[model samples]
Target: MIPELAPAKACAAKVLIADDEPNIVVSLEFMMKREGFEVLVARDGRAALEAIRREHPRLVLLDATMPGMSGFDVCEAVRADADVRSTCIVMLTAKGRETDMARGVGAGADAYVTKPFSTRDLVQQVKDMLAKDTAARALATGSAGAGELPKDMPA
Candidate 1:
Protein backbone atom coordinates (compact mmCIF):
# COMPACT_ATOMS: atom_id res chain seq x y z
CA MET A 1 0.00 0.00 0.00
CA ILE A 2 1.16 3.55 -0.75
CA PRO A 3 1.99 5.81 2.16
CA GLU A 4 -0.82 8.11 3.19
CA LEU A 5 -0.41 11.68 2.09
CA ALA A 6 -1.02 14.46 4.55
CA PRO A 7 -4.39 16.15 4.16
CA ALA A 8 -4.30 19.55 2.56
CA LYS A 9 -4.03 22.24 5.21
CA ALA A 10 -6.70 24.89 5.53
CA CYS A 11 -5.74 27.87 3.38
CA ALA A 12 -4.71 31.02 5.22
CA ALA A 13 -5.36 33.26 2.24
CA LYS A 14 -6.84 36.68 2.87
CA VAL A 15 -10.18 37.62 1.27
CA LEU A 16 -11.87 41.00 1.18
CA ILE A 17 -15.63 41.39 0.83
CA ALA A 18 -16.51 44.77 -0.63
CA ASP A 19 -20.22 45.45 -0.41
CA ASP A 20 -22.41 48.06 1.23
CA GLU A 21 -25.20 45.69 2.20
CA PRO A 22 -25.03 44.69 5.85
CA ASN A 23 -26.67 41.31 5.35
CA ILE A 24 -24.44 40.40 2.45
CA VAL A 25 -21.36 41.45 4.37
CA VAL A 26 -22.27 39.33 7.38
CA SER A 27 -23.22 36.26 5.37
CA LEU A 28 -20.13 36.37 3.15
CA GLU A 29 -17.91 37.00 6.13
CA PHE A 30 -19.31 34.00 7.96
CA MET A 31 -18.99 31.76 4.93
CA MET A 32 -15.38 32.77 4.16
CA LYS A 33 -14.29 32.55 7.77
CA ARG A 34 -15.80 29.09 8.06
CA GLU A 35 -13.71 28.05 5.08
CA GLY A 36 -10.51 29.27 6.86
CA PHE A 37 -9.89 32.57 5.11
CA GLU A 38 -8.86 35.68 6.97
CA VAL A 39 -11.60 38.14 5.96
CA LEU A 40 -11.76 41.93 5.62
CA VAL A 41 -14.98 43.86 5.02
CA ALA A 42 -15.28 47.12 3.11
CA ARG A 43 -18.61 48.92 3.14
CA ASP A 44 -17.90 51.09 0.11
CA GLY A 45 -15.98 50.95 -3.12
CA ARG A 46 -13.36 53.47 -2.04
CA ALA A 47 -12.91 51.67 1.23
CA ALA A 48 -12.59 48.41 -0.63
CA LEU A 49 -9.79 49.77 -2.78
CA GLU A 50 -8.08 51.17 0.28
CA ALA A 51 -8.32 47.87 2.09
CA ILE A 52 -6.98 46.06 -0.95
CA ARG A 53 -4.06 48.44 -1.31
CA ARG A 54 -3.20 48.34 2.35
CA GLU A 55 -3.93 44.70 3.18
CA HIS A 56 -3.11 43.07 -0.19
CA PRO A 57 -5.65 40.28 0.12
CA ARG A 58 -5.20 37.43 -2.31
CA LEU A 59 -8.85 37.56 -3.32
CA VAL A 60 -11.68 40.09 -3.32
CA LEU A 61 -15.47 39.67 -3.63
CA LEU A 62 -16.43 43.07 -4.92
CA ASP A 63 -19.96 44.40 -5.31
CA ALA A 64 -20.57 46.16 -8.60
CA THR A 65 -22.87 48.88 -7.34
CA MET A 66 -21.01 50.25 -4.35
CA PRO A 67 -21.26 53.94 -3.54
CA GLY A 68 -18.71 56.32 -5.08
CA MET A 69 -16.52 53.85 -7.00
CA SER A 70 -17.93 50.99 -9.00
CA GLY A 71 -16.51 47.47 -8.95
CA PHE A 72 -15.25 48.11 -12.46
CA ASP A 73 -13.14 50.97 -11.23
CA VAL A 74 -11.68 48.87 -8.46
CA CYS A 75 -10.98 45.98 -10.81
CA GLU A 76 -9.30 48.22 -13.35
CA ALA A 77 -7.18 49.85 -10.69
CA VAL A 78 -6.11 46.51 -9.23
CA ARG A 79 -5.24 45.16 -12.65
CA ALA A 80 -3.24 48.26 -13.46
CA ASP A 81 -1.20 48.09 -10.29
CA ALA A 82 1.73 45.76 -10.70
CA ASP A 83 2.02 45.31 -6.97
CA VAL A 84 -1.47 43.84 -6.65
CA ARG A 85 -2.37 42.87 -10.19
CA SER A 86 -2.23 39.20 -9.29
CA THR A 87 -5.08 39.62 -6.84
CA CYS A 88 -8.10 37.61 -7.97
CA ILE A 89 -11.25 39.72 -8.21
CA VAL A 90 -14.82 38.45 -8.48
CA MET A 91 -17.36 41.08 -9.45
CA LEU A 92 -20.63 40.52 -7.61
CA THR A 93 -23.48 42.27 -9.30
CA ALA A 94 -27.25 42.57 -9.34
CA LYS A 95 -27.02 43.46 -13.00
CA GLY A 96 -26.99 40.14 -14.81
CA ARG A 97 -27.11 41.42 -18.34
CA GLU A 98 -24.56 40.27 -20.90
CA THR A 99 -23.33 43.84 -21.17
CA ASP A 100 -22.69 43.91 -17.47
CA MET A 101 -20.71 40.70 -17.75
CA ALA A 102 -18.70 42.17 -20.60
CA ARG A 103 -18.04 45.31 -18.60
CA GLY A 104 -16.75 43.28 -15.70
CA VAL A 105 -14.45 41.21 -17.91
CA GLY A 106 -13.26 44.31 -19.67
CA ALA A 107 -12.31 45.79 -16.34
CA GLY A 108 -10.12 42.75 -15.65
CA ALA A 109 -12.27 40.91 -13.15
CA ASP A 110 -11.23 37.27 -12.92
CA ALA A 111 -14.78 36.10 -12.32
CA TYR A 112 -18.32 37.42 -12.01
CA VAL A 113 -21.14 36.28 -9.77
CA THR A 114 -24.76 37.31 -9.65
CA LYS A 115 -26.22 38.84 -6.49
CA PRO A 116 -28.29 35.78 -5.63
CA PHE A 117 -25.53 33.23 -5.99
CA SER A 118 -24.80 29.88 -4.48
CA THR A 119 -22.64 30.26 -1.42
CA ARG A 120 -21.28 26.77 -1.87
CA ASP A 121 -20.16 27.44 -5.43
CA LEU A 122 -18.61 30.76 -4.58
CA VAL A 123 -16.80 29.29 -1.61
CA GLN A 124 -15.49 26.48 -3.74
CA GLN A 125 -14.37 28.90 -6.42
CA VAL A 126 -12.56 30.96 -3.87
CA LYS A 127 -10.90 27.88 -2.47
CA ASP A 128 -9.84 26.77 -5.92
CA MET A 129 -8.42 30.14 -6.82
CA LEU A 130 -6.51 30.33 -3.56
CA ALA A 131 -5.12 26.84 -4.07
CA LYS A 132 -4.07 27.64 -7.62
CA ASP A 133 -2.44 30.86 -6.49
CA THR A 134 -0.51 29.02 -3.82
CA ALA A 135 0.67 26.41 -6.28
CA ALA A 136 1.73 29.04 -8.77
CA ARG A 137 3.76 30.82 -6.14
CA ALA A 138 5.38 27.59 -5.11
CA LEU A 139 6.23 26.74 -8.68
CA ALA A 140 7.59 30.20 -9.28
CA THR A 141 9.87 29.83 -6.28
CA GLY A 142 10.94 26.36 -7.40
CA SER A 143 9.73 24.78 -4.19
CA ALA A 144 7.06 22.54 -5.66
CA GLY A 145 7.81 20.07 -8.41
CA ALA A 146 6.67 21.09 -11.89
CA GLY A 147 5.19 17.65 -12.46
CA GLU A 148 2.66 17.99 -9.66
CA LEU A 149 -0.92 18.43 -10.83
CA PRO A 150 -3.25 20.75 -8.96
CA LYS A 151 -6.24 18.92 -7.56
CA ASP A 152 -8.64 20.78 -9.78
CA MET A 153 -6.79 20.08 -13.03
CA PRO A 154 -8.75 18.11 -15.58
CA ALA A 155 -7.30 14.71 -16.45
Candidate 2:
Protein backbone atom coordinates (compact mmCIF):
# COMPACT_ATOMS: atom_id res chain seq x y z
CA MET A 1 0.00 0.00 0.00
CA ILE A 2 1.25 3.54 -0.82
CA PRO A 3 1.63 5.98 2.01
CA GLU A 4 -0.44 9.16 2.02
CA LEU A 5 1.78 12.25 1.96
CA ALA A 6 0.84 15.49 3.68
CA PRO A 7 0.09 18.39 1.42
CA ALA A 8 2.57 21.23 1.16
CA LYS A 9 1.55 24.51 2.73
CA ALA A 10 2.47 27.97 1.54
CA CYS A 11 3.23 30.76 3.98
CA ALA A 12 0.34 33.09 4.71
CA ALA A 13 0.74 36.41 2.95
CA LYS A 14 1.13 39.55 5.06
CA VAL A 15 -1.19 42.50 4.51
CA LEU A 16 -0.98 45.88 6.19
CA ILE A 17 -4.02 48.07 6.72
CA ALA A 18 -2.88 51.69 7.12
CA ASP A 19 -5.87 53.88 7.82
CA ASP A 20 -6.97 56.35 10.51
CA GLU A 21 -10.65 55.46 10.63
CA PRO A 22 -11.30 52.94 13.37
CA ASN A 23 -14.38 51.48 11.75
CA ILE A 24 -12.68 50.92 8.42
CA VAL A 25 -9.64 49.44 10.07
CA VAL A 26 -11.73 47.00 12.09
CA SER A 27 -13.64 45.82 9.06
CA LEU A 28 -10.55 45.50 6.90
CA GLU A 29 -8.76 43.57 9.62
CA PHE A 30 -11.66 41.19 9.95
CA MET A 31 -11.93 40.59 6.23
CA MET A 32 -8.21 40.06 5.69
CA LYS A 33 -7.94 37.69 8.66
CA ARG A 34 -10.91 35.74 7.41
CA GLU A 35 -9.19 35.41 4.04
CA GLY A 36 -6.16 33.77 5.74
CA PHE A 37 -3.81 36.74 5.57
CA GLU A 38 -1.50 37.71 8.40
CA VAL A 39 -2.83 41.23 8.97
CA LEU A 40 -0.97 44.24 10.41
CA VAL A 41 -2.42 47.63 11.23
CA ALA A 42 -1.09 51.21 11.44
CA ARG A 43 -3.32 54.14 12.29
CA ASP A 44 -1.23 56.88 10.72
CA GLY A 45 1.12 57.46 7.81
CA ARG A 46 4.36 57.60 9.78
CA ALA A 47 3.49 54.44 11.58
CA ALA A 48 2.52 52.93 8.26
CA LEU A 49 5.94 53.64 6.79
CA GLU A 50 7.65 52.28 9.86
CA ALA A 51 5.66 49.06 9.69
CA ILE A 52 6.34 48.70 5.98
CA ARG A 53 10.08 48.97 6.53
CA ARG A 54 10.09 46.68 9.56
CA GLU A 55 7.56 43.98 8.71
CA HIS A 56 7.80 43.90 4.91
CA PRO A 57 4.19 43.07 4.19
CA ARG A 58 3.26 41.82 0.72
CA LEU A 59 0.59 44.46 0.30
CA VAL A 60 -0.46 47.72 1.97
CA LEU A 61 -3.94 49.24 2.12
CA LEU A 62 -3.09 52.91 2.71
CA ASP A 63 -5.15 55.96 3.53
CA ALA A 64 -4.35 59.22 1.76
CA THR A 65 -4.93 61.84 4.46
CA MET A 66 -3.29 60.43 7.55
CA PRO A 67 -2.10 62.38 10.60
CA GLY A 68 1.59 62.59 9.66
CA MET A 69 3.37 61.49 6.51
CA SER A 70 0.25 60.89 4.33
CA GLY A 71 -0.26 57.85 2.11
CA PHE A 72 1.30 59.53 -0.88
CA ASP A 73 4.38 60.32 1.12
CA VAL A 74 4.64 56.77 2.38
CA CYS A 75 4.18 55.36 -1.11
CA GLU A 76 6.85 57.62 -2.52
CA ALA A 77 9.20 56.76 0.28
CA VAL A 78 8.64 53.06 -0.29
CA ARG A 79 9.35 53.41 -4.00
CA ALA A 80 12.54 55.34 -3.33
CA ASP A 81 13.82 52.77 -0.86
CA ALA A 82 15.47 49.83 -2.62
CA ASP A 83 14.67 47.32 0.09
CA VAL A 84 10.87 47.73 -0.03
CA ARG A 85 10.31 49.17 -3.49
CA SER A 86 8.66 45.95 -4.70
CA THR A 87 6.05 46.09 -1.94
CA CYS A 88 2.53 46.53 -3.30
CA ILE A 89 0.51 49.57 -2.20
CA VAL A 90 -3.21 50.06 -2.67
CA MET A 91 -4.56 53.45 -1.59
CA LEU A 92 -7.87 53.39 0.25
CA THR A 93 -9.05 56.91 0.86
CA ALA A 94 -12.01 59.29 0.84
CA LYS A 95 -10.23 61.43 -1.74
CA GLY A 96 -11.79 60.07 -4.93
CA ARG A 97 -11.04 62.88 -7.32
CA GLU A 98 -9.25 62.29 -10.60
CA THR A 99 -6.22 64.27 -9.47
CA ASP A 100 -6.06 62.29 -6.24
CA MET A 101 -6.02 59.02 -8.16
CA ALA A 102 -3.40 60.40 -10.49
CA ARG A 103 -1.28 61.52 -7.58
CA GLY A 104 -1.61 58.14 -5.87
CA VAL A 105 -0.46 56.37 -9.03
CA GLY A 106 2.35 58.85 -9.52
CA ALA A 107 3.50 58.17 -5.98
CA GLY A 108 3.66 54.40 -6.71
CA ALA A 109 0.31 53.04 -5.54
CA ASP A 110 -0.61 49.88 -7.46
CA ALA A 111 -4.30 50.59 -7.06
CA TYR A 112 -6.60 53.33 -5.65
CA VAL A 113 -9.83 52.42 -3.89
CA THR A 114 -12.15 55.19 -2.72
CA LYS A 115 -14.33 55.37 0.39
CA PRO A 116 -17.73 53.64 0.62
CA PHE A 117 -16.14 50.77 -1.27
CA SER A 118 -17.40 47.19 -1.18
CA THR A 119 -15.38 44.95 1.08
CA ARG A 120 -15.95 41.93 -1.17
CA ASP A 121 -14.61 43.76 -4.18
CA LEU A 122 -11.65 44.98 -2.22
CA VAL A 123 -10.77 41.47 -1.14
CA GLN A 124 -11.00 40.20 -4.70
CA GLN A 125 -8.88 43.06 -5.95
CA VAL A 126 -6.25 42.38 -3.34
CA LYS A 127 -6.10 38.72 -4.31
CA ASP A 128 -5.72 39.55 -7.97
CA MET A 129 -3.04 42.12 -7.37
CA LEU A 130 -1.04 39.84 -5.11
CA ALA A 131 -1.22 37.00 -7.63
CA LYS A 132 -0.09 39.25 -10.44
CA ASP A 133 2.73 40.68 -8.40
CA THR A 134 3.94 37.24 -7.38
CA ALA A 135 3.89 36.04 -10.97
CA ALA A 136 5.81 39.07 -12.13
CA ARG A 137 8.43 38.63 -9.46
CA ALA A 138 8.80 34.95 -10.22
CA LEU A 139 9.24 35.68 -13.90
CA ALA A 140 11.75 38.44 -13.24
CA THR A 141 13.79 36.07 -11.10
CA GLY A 142 13.66 33.29 -13.75
CA SER A 143 11.43 31.16 -11.58
CA ALA A 144 8.46 30.91 -13.90
CA GLY A 145 7.76 27.40 -12.61
CA ALA A 146 7.76 28.51 -9.00
CA GLY A 147 4.13 27.60 -8.43
CA GLU A 148 4.38 24.13 -9.92
CA LEU A 149 4.33 21.14 -7.63
CA PRO A 150 7.28 18.77 -7.76
CA LYS A 151 7.02 15.65 -9.93
CA ASP A 152 7.10 13.45 -6.83
CA MET A 153 4.13 15.33 -5.33
CA PRO A 154 0.66 13.93 -5.95
CA ALA A 155 -1.98 16.03 -7.63
Candidate 3:
Protein backbone atom coordinates (compact mmCIF):
# COMPACT_ATOMS: atom_id res chain seq x y z
CA MET A 1 0.00 0.00 0.00
CA ILE A 2 3.02 2.27 -0.19
CA PRO A 3 3.60 4.80 -2.97
CA GLU A 4 3.85 3.15 -6.40
CA LEU A 5 6.85 3.21 -8.68
CA ALA A 6 7.09 6.19 -11.13
CA PRO A 7 7.59 4.49 -14.50
CA ALA A 8 4.78 2.11 -13.52
CA LYS A 9 2.40 5.05 -13.50
CA ALA A 10 2.40 5.09 -17.30
CA CYS A 11 2.55 1.40 -18.30
CA ALA A 12 0.64 0.06 -15.28
CA ALA A 13 1.96 -3.48 -15.49
CA LYS A 14 1.61 -5.02 -12.04
CA VAL A 15 4.45 -6.69 -10.12
CA LEU A 16 4.24 -8.43 -6.75
CA ILE A 17 7.01 -8.15 -4.17
CA ALA A 18 7.23 -10.71 -1.33
CA ASP A 19 9.74 -9.96 1.37
CA ASP A 20 9.81 -9.72 5.15
CA GLU A 21 12.03 -6.63 5.36
CA PRO A 22 10.19 -3.34 5.09
CA ASN A 23 13.18 -1.46 3.73
CA ILE A 24 13.79 -4.04 1.02
CA VAL A 25 10.19 -3.94 -0.09
CA VAL A 26 10.21 -0.14 -0.15
CA SER A 27 13.42 0.04 -2.10
CA LEU A 28 12.30 -2.58 -4.63
CA GLU A 29 8.90 -0.96 -5.06
CA PHE A 30 10.54 2.38 -5.80
CA MET A 31 13.04 0.87 -8.19
CA MET A 32 10.41 -1.21 -10.02
CA LYS A 33 8.25 1.87 -10.42
CA ARG A 34 11.18 3.80 -11.83
CA GLU A 35 11.53 0.97 -14.35
CA GLY A 36 7.82 1.23 -15.32
CA PHE A 37 6.16 -1.58 -13.34
CA GLU A 38 3.17 -1.26 -11.00
CA VAL A 39 4.23 -2.72 -7.65
CA LEU A 40 2.44 -4.72 -4.94
CA VAL A 41 4.03 -5.69 -1.64
CA ALA A 42 3.44 -8.69 0.69
CA ARG A 43 5.35 -8.92 3.95
CA ASP A 44 5.08 -12.70 4.23
CA GLY A 45 4.24 -15.85 2.25
CA ARG A 46 0.58 -16.01 3.26
CA ALA A 47 0.10 -12.40 2.26
CA ALA A 48 1.86 -13.17 -0.99
CA LEU A 49 -0.59 -16.01 -1.71
CA GLU A 50 -3.51 -13.68 -1.08
CA ALA A 51 -2.08 -10.99 -3.30
CA ILE A 52 -1.49 -13.46 -6.09
CA ARG A 53 -5.10 -14.56 -5.85
CA ARG A 54 -6.44 -11.02 -5.79
CA GLU A 55 -4.07 -9.04 -8.00
CA HIS A 56 -2.41 -11.66 -10.26
CA PRO A 57 0.75 -9.72 -11.04
CA ARG A 58 2.89 -10.42 -14.11
CA LEU A 59 5.92 -11.20 -11.96
CA VAL A 60 6.72 -11.97 -8.33
CA LEU A 61 9.96 -11.24 -6.47
CA LEU A 62 10.04 -13.64 -3.55
CA ASP A 63 12.39 -13.54 -0.63
CA ALA A 64 13.83 -16.92 0.31
CA THR A 65 13.77 -16.27 4.04
CA MET A 66 10.74 -14.99 5.95
CA PRO A 67 9.19 -15.38 9.36
CA GLY A 68 6.20 -17.37 8.11
CA MET A 69 5.61 -19.37 4.94
CA SER A 70 9.13 -19.15 3.63
CA GLY A 71 9.77 -18.35 -0.01
CA PHE A 72 9.91 -22.04 -0.88
CA ASP A 73 6.46 -22.58 0.56
CA VAL A 74 5.15 -19.59 -1.32
CA CYS A 75 6.65 -20.83 -4.52
CA GLU A 76 5.08 -24.22 -4.04
CA ALA A 77 1.70 -22.67 -3.48
CA VAL A 78 2.01 -20.53 -6.59
CA ARG A 79 3.07 -23.47 -8.73
CA ALA A 80 0.14 -25.46 -7.49
CA ASP A 81 -2.38 -22.79 -8.38
CA ALA A 82 -3.52 -23.30 -11.96
CA ASP A 83 -4.64 -19.70 -12.33
CA VAL A 84 -1.33 -18.13 -11.34
CA ARG A 85 1.14 -20.94 -11.96
CA SER A 86 2.43 -19.26 -15.10
CA THR A 87 3.31 -16.10 -13.24
CA CYS A 88 7.01 -15.35 -13.51
CA ILE A 89 8.83 -15.74 -10.19
CA VAL A 90 12.25 -14.45 -9.24
CA MET A 91 13.69 -15.42 -5.87
CA LEU A 92 15.48 -12.78 -3.81
CA THR A 93 17.67 -13.63 -0.86
CA ALA A 94 20.89 -12.83 0.97
CA LYS A 95 21.74 -16.50 1.05
CA GLY A 96 23.86 -17.36 -1.98
CA ARG A 97 24.66 -20.88 -0.91
CA GLU A 98 24.60 -23.55 -3.60
CA THR A 99 22.14 -25.60 -1.56
CA ASP A 100 19.84 -22.61 -1.31
CA MET A 101 19.94 -22.21 -5.06
CA ALA A 102 19.05 -25.86 -5.46
CA ARG A 103 16.08 -25.44 -3.16
CA GLY A 104 14.88 -22.39 -5.06
CA VAL A 105 15.09 -24.33 -8.31
CA GLY A 106 13.22 -27.20 -6.75
CA ALA A 107 10.47 -24.78 -5.71
CA GLY A 108 9.82 -23.97 -9.42
CA ALA A 109 10.90 -20.35 -9.58
CA ASP A 110 11.39 -19.10 -13.12
CA ALA A 111 14.41 -17.03 -12.19
CA TYR A 112 16.62 -16.37 -9.19
CA VAL A 113 18.59 -13.25 -8.32
CA THR A 114 20.68 -12.71 -5.25
CA LYS A 115 20.44 -9.80 -2.84
CA PRO A 116 22.46 -6.62 -3.42
CA PHE A 117 21.65 -7.15 -7.08
CA SER A 118 22.23 -4.23 -9.39
CA THR A 119 19.19 -2.11 -10.14
CA ARG A 120 19.97 -2.37 -13.83
CA ASP A 121 19.89 -6.14 -13.64
CA LEU A 122 16.58 -6.21 -11.87
CA VAL A 123 14.98 -3.85 -14.38
CA GLN A 124 16.30 -5.88 -17.29
CA GLN A 125 14.97 -9.07 -15.74
CA VAL A 126 11.50 -7.58 -15.44
CA LYS A 127 11.56 -6.41 -19.02
CA ASP A 128 12.70 -9.80 -20.18
CA MET A 129 9.96 -11.54 -18.23
CA LEU A 130 7.27 -9.26 -19.62
CA ALA A 131 8.51 -9.77 -23.15
CA LYS A 132 8.57 -13.51 -22.67
CA ASP A 133 5.05 -13.48 -21.34
CA THR A 134 3.85 -11.48 -24.29
CA ALA A 135 5.43 -13.93 -26.66
CA ALA A 136 3.95 -16.89 -24.86
CA ARG A 137 0.48 -15.43 -24.93
CA ALA A 138 0.79 -14.61 -28.57
CA LEU A 139 1.77 -18.16 -29.35
CA ALA A 140 -1.01 -19.61 -27.22
CA THR A 141 -3.60 -17.39 -28.91
CA GLY A 142 -2.31 -18.33 -32.37
CA SER A 143 -1.79 -14.65 -33.11
CA ALA A 144 1.91 -14.33 -33.67
CA GLY A 145 0.79 -11.78 -36.26
CA ALA A 146 -0.09 -12.24 -39.95
CA GLY A 147 2.49 -14.11 -42.01
CA GLU A 148 4.55 -14.71 -38.88
CA LEU A 149 5.11 -17.69 -36.66
CA PRO A 150 6.94 -18.11 -33.43
CA LYS A 151 10.69 -18.13 -33.90
CA ASP A 152 10.91 -21.73 -32.75
CA MET A 153 8.17 -23.02 -35.00
CA PRO A 154 9.26 -25.09 -37.96
CA ALA A 155 9.41 -22.95 -41.07
Candidate 4:
Protein backbone atom coordinates (compact mmCIF):
# COMPACT_ATOMS: atom_id res chain seq x y z
CA MET A 1 0.00 0.00 0.00
CA ILE A 2 1.22 3.46 -0.83
CA PRO A 3 0.77 5.50 2.33
CA GLU A 4 1.17 8.79 0.52
CA LEU A 5 0.12 9.80 -2.94
CA ALA A 6 2.94 10.17 -5.41
CA PRO A 7 3.14 13.13 -7.75
CA ALA A 8 1.72 12.46 -11.24
CA LYS A 9 -0.12 9.40 -9.98
CA ALA A 10 -3.77 8.96 -10.81
CA CYS A 11 -6.64 7.45 -8.91
CA ALA A 12 -6.50 3.68 -9.24
CA ALA A 13 -6.42 2.89 -12.94
CA LYS A 14 -6.83 -0.83 -13.43
CA VAL A 15 -3.58 -2.23 -14.89
CA LEU A 16 -2.68 -5.72 -15.98
CA ILE A 17 0.84 -7.08 -15.43
CA ALA A 18 1.33 -10.12 -17.60
CA ASP A 19 4.44 -12.20 -17.08
CA ASP A 20 5.33 -15.86 -16.58
CA GLU A 21 8.07 -15.20 -14.06
CA PRO A 22 6.73 -15.45 -10.53
CA ASN A 23 9.29 -13.10 -9.03
CA ILE A 24 8.69 -10.41 -11.60
CA VAL A 25 4.94 -10.72 -11.17
CA VAL A 26 5.17 -10.29 -7.42
CA SER A 27 7.37 -7.26 -7.71
CA LEU A 28 5.18 -5.66 -10.35
CA GLU A 29 2.05 -6.23 -8.31
CA PHE A 30 3.57 -4.58 -5.29
CA MET A 31 4.82 -1.64 -7.30
CA MET A 32 1.52 -1.05 -9.04
CA LYS A 33 -0.38 -1.25 -5.77
CA ARG A 34 1.92 1.33 -4.30
CA GLU A 35 1.26 3.57 -7.26
CA GLY A 36 -2.49 3.46 -6.60
CA PHE A 37 -3.34 1.29 -9.60
CA GLU A 38 -5.36 -1.88 -9.29
CA VAL A 39 -3.06 -4.58 -10.57
CA LEU A 40 -4.08 -7.73 -12.46
CA VAL A 41 -1.85 -10.60 -13.51
CA ALA A 42 -1.68 -13.33 -16.14
CA ARG A 43 0.98 -16.02 -16.40
CA ASP A 44 0.65 -16.64 -20.09
CA GLY A 45 -0.28 -14.83 -23.27
CA ARG A 46 -3.65 -16.56 -23.66
CA ALA A 47 -4.77 -15.74 -20.15
CA ALA A 48 -3.54 -12.19 -20.65
CA LEU A 49 -5.73 -11.75 -23.70
CA GLU A 50 -8.71 -13.26 -21.91
CA ALA A 51 -8.24 -10.90 -18.99
CA ILE A 52 -7.89 -7.91 -21.31
CA ARG A 53 -11.19 -8.76 -22.98
CA ARG A 54 -12.92 -9.34 -19.69
CA GLU A 55 -11.54 -6.48 -17.62
CA HIS A 56 -10.79 -3.86 -20.22
CA PRO A 57 -8.08 -2.41 -18.04
CA ARG A 58 -6.66 1.07 -18.57
CA LEU A 59 -3.20 -0.32 -19.18
CA VAL A 60 -1.42 -3.61 -19.76
CA LEU A 61 2.24 -4.32 -18.87
CA LEU A 62 2.78 -7.21 -21.23
CA ASP A 63 5.78 -9.49 -21.31
CA ALA A 64 7.19 -9.69 -24.82
CA THR A 65 7.77 -13.42 -24.60
CA MET A 66 5.64 -16.18 -23.14
CA PRO A 67 5.06 -19.92 -23.50
CA GLY A 68 2.24 -19.62 -26.04
CA MET A 69 0.88 -16.74 -28.08
CA SER A 70 3.59 -14.14 -27.58
CA GLY A 71 2.92 -10.60 -26.38
CA PHE A 72 3.24 -9.39 -29.94
CA ASP A 73 0.25 -11.52 -30.83
CA VAL A 74 -1.74 -10.23 -27.89
CA CYS A 75 -0.93 -6.60 -28.71
CA GLU A 76 -1.94 -7.14 -32.30
CA ALA A 77 -5.22 -8.67 -31.24
CA VAL A 78 -5.97 -5.77 -28.93
CA ARG A 79 -5.23 -3.27 -31.68
CA ALA A 80 -7.51 -5.10 -34.09
CA ASP A 81 -10.41 -4.73 -31.68
CA ALA A 82 -12.00 -1.30 -31.93
CA ASP A 83 -13.34 -1.45 -28.38
CA VAL A 84 -9.95 -2.12 -26.84
CA ARG A 85 -7.74 -0.17 -29.23
CA SER A 86 -7.65 2.80 -26.89
CA THR A 87 -6.23 0.69 -24.08
CA CYS A 88 -2.64 1.64 -23.26
CA ILE A 89 -0.03 -1.08 -23.64
CA VAL A 90 3.50 -1.19 -22.23
CA MET A 91 5.55 -4.11 -23.47
CA LEU A 92 7.96 -5.38 -20.79
CA THR A 93 10.55 -8.05 -21.46
CA ALA A 94 14.24 -8.92 -21.63
CA LYS A 95 14.45 -8.40 -25.38
CA GLY A 96 15.91 -4.90 -25.61
CA ARG A 97 16.97 -4.97 -29.22
CA GLU A 98 15.91 -2.26 -31.67
CA THR A 99 14.04 -4.82 -33.74
CA ASP A 100 12.14 -5.99 -30.69
CA MET A 101 11.05 -2.46 -29.93
CA ALA A 102 10.03 -1.97 -33.53
CA ARG A 103 7.97 -5.13 -33.48
CA GLY A 104 6.26 -3.99 -30.29
CA VAL A 105 5.47 -0.61 -31.79
CA GLY A 106 4.18 -2.22 -34.97
CA ALA A 107 1.95 -4.40 -32.81
CA GLY A 108 0.51 -1.24 -31.23
CA ALA A 109 2.26 -1.11 -27.88
CA ASP A 110 2.28 2.37 -26.39
CA ALA A 111 5.61 1.84 -24.67
CA TYR A 112 8.40 -0.71 -24.44
CA VAL A 113 10.25 -1.38 -21.17
CA THR A 114 13.12 -3.80 -20.98
CA LYS A 115 13.86 -6.13 -18.08
CA PRO A 116 15.96 -4.93 -15.13
CA PHE A 117 14.02 -1.72 -15.42
CA SER A 118 14.00 0.76 -12.59
CA THR A 119 10.70 0.67 -10.73
CA ARG A 120 10.71 4.45 -10.27
CA ASP A 121 11.12 5.05 -14.00
CA LEU A 122 8.41 2.56 -14.77
CA VAL A 123 6.02 4.24 -12.38
CA GLN A 124 6.71 7.67 -13.83
CA GLN A 125 6.31 6.40 -17.38
CA VAL A 126 3.03 4.72 -16.50
CA LYS A 127 1.71 7.91 -14.97
CA ASP A 128 2.71 9.99 -17.96
CA MET A 129 1.23 7.61 -20.53
CA LEU A 130 -2.00 7.21 -18.63
CA ALA A 131 -2.30 10.98 -18.33
CA LYS A 132 -1.80 11.48 -22.05
CA ASP A 133 -4.29 8.73 -22.81
CA THR A 134 -6.88 10.34 -20.55
CA ALA A 135 -6.35 13.66 -22.25
CA ALA A 136 -6.76 12.11 -25.65
CA ARG A 137 -9.96 10.42 -24.59
CA ALA A 138 -11.38 13.66 -23.32
CA LEU A 139 -10.53 15.36 -26.56
CA ALA A 140 -12.08 12.53 -28.54
CA THR A 141 -15.28 12.80 -26.55
CA GLY A 142 -15.32 16.62 -26.68
CA SER A 143 -15.61 16.65 -22.92
CA ALA A 144 -12.60 18.83 -22.18
CA GLY A 145 -12.39 22.55 -22.81
CA ALA A 146 -10.46 23.82 -25.82
CA GLY A 147 -7.67 25.18 -23.65
CA GLU A 148 -7.72 22.69 -20.82
CA LEU A 149 -6.03 19.40 -21.23
CA PRO A 150 -7.91 16.74 -19.31
CA LYS A 151 -7.32 17.22 -15.58
CA ASP A 152 -4.99 20.13 -16.24
CA MET A 153 -2.46 17.87 -17.90
CA PRO A 154 0.65 19.69 -19.15
CA ALA A 155 1.22 19.96 -22.87
Top candidate, metric lDDT: 2
Alpha-carbon runs more than 4 Å astray in model 1: 1-11, 146-155
Q: Which candidate's TM-score is highest?
A: 2
lDDT for each candidate structure: 0.88, 0.90, 0.84, 0.88
Q: How accurate is candidate 4 locally (lDDT)?
A: 0.88
Worst 10 residues of 1 by lDDT: 146-155
The stretch of ten residues in a row with the least summed lDDT in candidate 3 is: 146-155
- What is candidate 2's lDDT per residue for 92-135, written digit by digit as tens? 98898999999999999999999999999999998888887877
Q: Estimate each model's TM-score.
A: 0.85, 0.89, 0.83, 0.85
Score residue 148 of candidate 3 by CA lDDT: 53
> Model 3 over residues 105-144: C-alpha lDDT tens digits?
8999888888888867887888778777868888798778
After superposition, candidate 4 runs with Cα above 4 Å error: 1-11, 145-155
- Over 4 Å off in model 2, which ranges? 1-5, 146-155
lDDT of 4 at 144: 79
Candidates 2 and 4 compared: the better one by lDDT is 2
Global fold similarity of model 1 (TM-score): 0.85
Writing each residue's lDDT as its tens digit, candidate 4 over 1-103 gives 8698667733468899989999989988998888778889999999999999999999999999997889999999999998888889999989999999999
Better of 1 and 2 by lDDT: 2
